[model samples]
Target: MMGNRALLMNFMEKFLETVRFGNNDFAVIAGYGDVVI
Candidate 1:
């Protein structure tokens, strides 16, 4: 579980970096049903 979270963080960082947003304001939300992370 820890490893998976770490991997997700790494991927998100790379993605956000590529976007190059100055403010870097974003949200990852669960939509519909019962979402679990």
Candidate 2:
């Protein structure tokens, strides 16, 4: 059970990182919206 919990935590951390990266990419695009349009 402990090992499974550790694995789940590791997966959660990676998922969070991916989510953060996606948010940063979205913010960058929104910031440049005026020029993009």
Output the worst ten-in-a-row residue range by lDDT, candidate 1: 26-35
Give the best candidate by TM-score.
2
**Once superposed on the true structure, which residue ranges of model 1 sit more than 4 Å away at CA?**
21-37
Q: Worst lDDT window (10 residues) for model 2?
A: 28-37
Instruction: State the lDDT of candidate 2 residue by residue for 1-37, as single tens digits.
Output: 9976776666556556656777766555544552334
TM-score of candidate 1 versus the correct structure, residues matched by position: 0.53
| Model 2 stretches astray by more than 4 angstroms | 23-37
Residues 1-37 of candidate 1 have per-residue lDDT tens digits of 9987776776666556645754333322211111233
For model 2, the local distance difference test gives: 0.58
Candidate 1 displacement at residue 15 in angstroms: 0.2
Question: Per-residue lDDT for 2 in model 2?
Answer: 100
